[model samples]
Target: MSSFPQIPQTIADEQQLDDWLTTPSSELIEFVRTLSGDLLVLGAGGKMGPSLAVRAKRAIDAAGSPASVIAVSRFSDTTSRQWLDDRGVVTHAADLLDRNAVEAIPDAANVLYMVGTKFGTSQNPAFTWAINTVASSQVMQRFAGSRFVALSTGNVYPFVPVASGGATEDGPIGPVGEYANAALGRERVFQYFSTCNGTPVTLMRLNYAVDLRYGVLTDIGLRVFSGEPVDLRNGYLNCIWQGDANDAIIRALGTAESPHCLLNLTGQETLSVRAIANEFARLLERPVQFTGEETESALLSNSAKCCDLLGAPQISTETMIRWTADWLRQKGRLLNKPTHFEVRDGKF
Candidate 1:
């Protein structure tokens, strides 16, 4: 494995966070240059969208391209809107479910669809279906002419044996719970529209994109640091750095096909929850607790095709573990969003 720049031990302020968010690689710059016209990111208020939008804008600027990066979301929290605005990413506030609102979004030659719901699925499965399935239909209808890279979850795939090195893009679509099923619907809707209108589409099945604020690594690190018991049932998993995910999402624009392309985008390694907790304990000098036993199968993905298409992730799991531990120990800012990656039943 080639070494990448290590994340700083401590991030002092929001400015540092912004710097980390927008930094791009040479590949990203070349990818952004290839994209012409405006770049629209739907569902830009989510955990990954803000940084991704900023990264796109920065990449376009670096490449000296004329394309503008526009982020569309409800912007219920003005903080996120301000964050994107400060970074020169144009922000649009609108409910994606609203047909008029979605149609009103400026036309773009390239788009990254990030709209989807995971939490509150049990209590309100209808809304989950609407957001994941219905909204996807709306976005596809609205952006039928644009080159699209839709973000789908790896939850669409069934659990596989740890020794399998995770499920590939051709894995069966047997989602475990309501949320997972709806995610499958989301992909189907996009596929349907792509086929109907002959629009180019790329369905990116992302597993876990880790960062200090919110991810499987941070979730486990914080649990270990807090001395809480980490569940081990879903022991093996895959993760990629949020920055790497963002870059791959952008680069997927070029890989879009008329009948739609499906690709798994995640880390190559199949990580163990038990081992991750121990790594966290080692880094933070804290006691770690574990409950339950490792299961034979777990939600995992094989991103070989994506890595072959795009490049391998720069940030390694070791770097992420150390960064997460130092961030927790130093009391860095947190998004307070729990990934709930340990949920074996896929409740969330």
Candidate 2:
């Protein structure tokens, strides 16, 4: 593997940001070199999927591996599909909900399952269930013979005391609200299918993944930049840099097991919203506003296991805050998708 690129003091533009996000680390390249077959990334049009797919492709290319990277999504946004194509990732337009469409998907030796609905759960919960549960069932059935690293959410685990350092993988799970329950259902579906078919699977429970464009840090930094009050109800959270998270996700193919291997994927720290907002204020030269008091518990996860298995995230939370502030200072593009990290009811 070549020498890793130096982390930029500040990302200057979207192209730079994309290039940074999709650059594979030495470890990831090593893993891809030994990867036996084609890598299929389902739901590759979402916020994190494009970068993950591109990163995998870069790794495969860097390692001079023969494996191909195929990204599947509905392609509702043609630009995302085109972006993947431009990056040398094969694109397939398909809705996983349609069994026929899934049936037509090319078979692969490994799969990164990224399909799930989260944002509109309150407004159209049935669709959320269909996408999270039904779609998961369909994909699991289709890819039963392939190894899977399916994306689950930290939301599946109920709120824990902020001082507990987040919930561990073997901890009790009590999913709240429709979206959480459905996410858990997706995991259950993977487990059921894996057990029935003897497929190796890894369920990655990720909390917040911060990219310069959108994330917990961006949400807070944007609020501070705009002079809006950052809510403190859900006081603490955990996040990993999206690049590191993507690397870890790709490397997790090694952790797949017969029934299912559950891993919480995030940074090790239990970050405080108030502290992060104040730091953003300092970096952005803006006065941060605040609303509500810190809660005793929040949706957080313990990723020590992930760090131990795949190595810790290269970027730190402090670095993420700084990058987010700098990105906002330069008027970097925002995805306009709020994480709603403050939501206690879990409606979304």
Candidate 3:
């Protein structure tokens, strides 16, 4: 009997929610079995949190005992709370930044630190560092003996490769923009976890997560179908479907028993920005035109490690693009969607 709350059939329904669920896999089931106690998912209101929480419930159900799932989130509304309650997941709405607040989290034997911050506002650094870094450190310290699966981004790897391209887990973190510190926050948190043998930390360095709400595929589709101009850049990009991303992370947690493990999460194929734009144009029947000079991206990570560690994702990039386009057409967001989200120097 499956106790996992079923994820909605469509992205619109899920995103509107207080919460959503990721597709569960066999490997994920195995990982949940290894856990000795309840699985706590930090930042459970975010994109993948709901799914992870539900998956935990399913795992517990499979084990024939109700494993506790504590989902910590400040943004989750009543609907989100109800979803967790329906699935028997304990939901907590508290700021992780305060050490006192973080201390409130029951000491979980296994913790998935799924917290993150992007799109920083003017006064966001305090909250960013607090939630992204300090809170994680506090949580790690709180659950000293618990194993932690912390999320990292491929953004840590330098883009376009200055000396050489295709960054490995060892690649120097060369993130750009005012958001650079935000990128480093993951490293700092897990580094704290790495110190104690109690909390073995596994960092998942993810590339672009392909989702309809945001990411490369949707951005390109919006531009092409909306008849907008393409913004070209000089860089090789790697992406994985959001579902695949969830698979990879679940695998990481399942396999990780030692600390200081860092795996890069991305698709095997690398394509230029223009190449992807052209593909979208072909799909949308629009001309792929660019109005900007090719600027270099500072970070591009290699996913060979993840491929070898966790099985390679079965979904192809071509399929990802088609799904994203179809999703947009369904949402009716194609016409006015901006091609490239970022516009630099008066050009796309």
Off by over 4 Å in 2: 1-3
Better candidate number, 1 or 3, judged by lDDT = 1
lDDT of each: 0.88, 0.92, 0.67
TM-score rank order: 2, 1, 3
Candidate 1 C-alpha lDDT tens digits along 142-232: 8888999999999989999989988888767789999999999999999999999999999999999987888989899999999999989
Q: Top model by TM-score, which number?
A: 2
Count: clashes, candidate 2: 0
Cα-lDDT of candidate 2: 0.92
Models sorted by lDDT, best on top: 2, 1, 3
Candidate 3 residue lDDT tens string, 1-348:
112234334445334422333445666676667768877888888766776787667657765655788888885467777777787788888788777888887767778878877554235666665666777777777887877778876655545552344688875676554345565776776775676554577888877776566677777667777777766654356778766676566557655554578888788776676777788787667777675666555346778877887777766687777766657667633323322334321121
Query: Could you tell which candidate, 1 or 3, scores higher by TM-score?
Result: 1
Give the winner by TM-score: 1 or 2: 2
Name the runs in model 3 displaced over 4 angstroms. Answer: 1-21, 62-65, 121-123, 162-165, 255-259, 295-298, 332-348
lDDT of 2 by residue, 1-348 (tens): 122588888888999999989999998998887789999999999999999999999999999998999999999999999999998999999999999999999999999999988998999999999998899899988888899999999998989998999999999998989999999999999999999999999999999999999999999999999999999999899998999999999999999999899999999898999999999999988898999999789998999888888888888787888889989998988999999999989898
